[model samples]
Target: MLYWTLKYVLLGPLLKLFWPTKVTGLDNIPKTGGAIVASNHLAVVDSFFLPTHVKRRIVFLAKSEYFTEPGIKGKFKKWFFSGTGQYPVDRSGGSAGQAALDTGVRLLREGRLLGVYPEGTRSPDGRLHKGKTGIARMALQARVPVIPVAMVGTDKVNPIGSKMWWPRRIEIHIGAPLDFSRYDGLAGDRFVERSIADEVMYNLMELSGQEYVDIYAARAKELADAEHAGTRVAVPMQEHARDATRTPETEAS
Candidate 1:
């Protein structure tokens, strides 16, 4: 398959040599069968880099926008996504979540790995956000193990505004697979769903060590945007300081 070919032959080896990342608790991943990998989303690299480090292929429900672009770039994006075990989901949960859940269940039923970020988007301040119940729904539907993964320091290597890759030490900490068979028969009730989602978030918090923000991706995005705006506000002050340092009166001359 192109995925493996590109990974083992190109990306994986290159990452090993150049990226030189470290992985911990990788054995927590199930070597066989269908399971869920519940992880914290940091940077865009989280998706590609996670897959490269894993032994088996992991399928993720990526945003539909990634597949809907123009020209050769779009074509390549679509091809790579499809070939690398990713499927498109609308992300708004308007019929899209169900469609993805359906596909996810199918993958699990067939004994494959399903990768999902319960936070739904990259953490705004690199802190874990309140997880949506989609991950819980998937586990309840599939009746499979959910592995907790925490990827640290990746945000710095490929932050939101960075145009190029900068080397940053990375660590992938995979926790043991969580067993949720205790609530096997109760999957539909809202209260039960929230309870399960909370438990999932708790485990993720332990693995990630991020401050838990109780909100969805949209709200987190708003907060992150505000922080970025603050950075812009401080930039002028920093520039002023630099300018003053260069002034003749401030200089030794």
Candidate 2:
């Protein structure tokens, strides 16, 4: 199959050469059936590293543009993306968002591992971002366990806007599966959704040790870009640190 061929036979070996991938608590992943692997998005490589480390084949929802480009490179991109167990979803708002979640739920119902970044996009400065409630909703709707995952040190290797990659140490931590049984039928409630999102973020914070921001990742990226342009804007790091200033209670929370 193209998946195994590209993974173990090709890109997998090359990935091992460039960056050392250290995975912890991989036993937490379920061997079969439907479950959600919720992860923190830091670098683009985060997508490649997390699922590959796991023994089972994990499917992810990627940007829809990848599936439909008008050239040879586009065809290759489509093949590679599909070969690697990724399906594209429209990133535009409204119907697109609903369709993505619907597809995820459908996959889970069929007993498959659905990988998702609750932040909706990658963090610009390697910090944690506010998680969307979609992951929680999918798990609750499908009645499956949600596994919290953390990927660290990848952003430093690939970084944002860099074509060249460097060797770097990477860590993938798979914490225990989070149980939302208590709120089994309450996924529709906003309060329950917020609580679930917080729980997912809590584990990611502990794993990656990145400062958590209660803002969307895409907005943070926009803010960071404005600051880089010398247009007089606030740095996301300092602002994020101010709220998540590392308190003992924060860890306990």
Candidate 3:
């Protein structure tokens, strides 16, 4: 299959040779069955490296734009992403978001490993961001465990807005699977979902030893961009609920 071919004979060997990745707690991943592999989104390459280390194929719900671009480059991207076990899903909110969650649940029910970045987007400042509750909902609905993975140093290798990748040491720390069976029937409850989402982020914070930001990564990016443009945007009151003990830091380039 194309996936194995790429992993074993093509891309995987090249990346391993250049990046020098170190993975720990890999045995925490279930040998077989549906489970959610929740991780912090550091950089785009996080997708590439994680899958190469895991034995089973990981199906990621990539943003639809990756599959819908025009022209020859777009065609190549579509073919490559599809061949590597990624499916396109609309990331727009409302109905599209719900539809993506449904697709993830369906995949889990079919006994496939679902890779998810609960932060919803890559961290704009190398700090862990609040997790979207969709991951919690999918796990509850699919009756699957959630495995937290921490990807360290990927941001350095694939810095945002940089076309070239640098050779950097990468560490992948896989944590024990989290079971939310106690909330088995509470999939649609927002409060319960938030609690579950927070728990996952907390584990990632500990695993990666990165500062935790309670705001969503998308919002942080928006704020950072606005600041860079010398404009002001109102901070959401809810984001102010972040821990007072933690001081905020400027966004990293």
Candidate 4:
């Protein structure tokens, strides 16, 4: 298959030689069955490095734009992403977001490994951001476990706005699977979904050792861009520094 070919024969060896990945706790990943691999988004290379290190094929829900671009380069990107086990989903909110969630749940139910960035977008400042509830909802809907993964040093290899990647040591830490069976049959409850999302984020914060920001990554990016553009926007103080020790169980209680 194309996925195996790329990971083993073509791109994987090249990436390993350059980056020299160090992986730990890889056995935490289930050898079989469906699970959601939730991770913190740092840089674009996080996607490439994580899949190559893992033995199983990880199907990620990529933004639709990657597959919809026009012309020759676009065609190659579409083919590459598709051949490497990525499926395009619209990131726009409302119906499009729901559609993506449905697609993820369907994949999980079909016993496939689904890689998800719970933060929804890459962090603008390398701090872990608050997670979207879509991942929690999908886990609940599919009755699957959620595995927390942390990719360290990927930001250095491919920083934001960089067109080329540099050789850097990469560390991948895979954490134990999280079970949400206690909240079974509560897929549509917004409060439950948020709690689950928070729990996953908490694990990622612990694993990656990155400062946790309670704001969504997309919003943080917008505020950062505005400030960079000389707009006087009141920046909201992040509460995570003070509340960093709080866990989801404590919040739920």
For residues 1-253, write the lDDT of model 2, one tens digit per residue.
8888878988788888778888899899998989988888766677677767888888887668788988999998898887777877765654656777878888899999988888877777778988777777888889899999988887788777776677999888899998888888886776687788888898889987889977877778887778888676654553332111010000000
TM-score of 4: 0.88
Error of 2 at 194 (Å): 0.9
Q: Indicate the TM-score of model 1.
A: 0.82
Q: TM per model?
A: 0.82, 0.86, 0.90, 0.88
Badly placed stretches (over 4 Å) of model 4 are 68-71, 90-94, 234-253
Query: Each prediction's Cα lDDT score?
Result: 0.73, 0.77, 0.85, 0.83
lDDT tens per residue, model 4, 30-62: 999999998887887777889999999998876
Error of 4 at 25 (Å): 0.8
Candidate 2 off by > 4 Å: 90-94, 229-253
**lDDT by residue (tens digit), candidate 3, 117-203:** 888778899989988888888999999999999999999998998867899999999999999999999988988988999999999
Clashing pairs in 3: none
Query: Highest lDDT, which number?
Result: 3
Query: Who wins the TM-score comparison?
Result: 3
Q: What is the lDDT of residue 141 in candidate 3?
A: 95
Where model 1 places Cα greater than 4 Å from the true spot, the runs are: 64-71, 90-94, 224-253
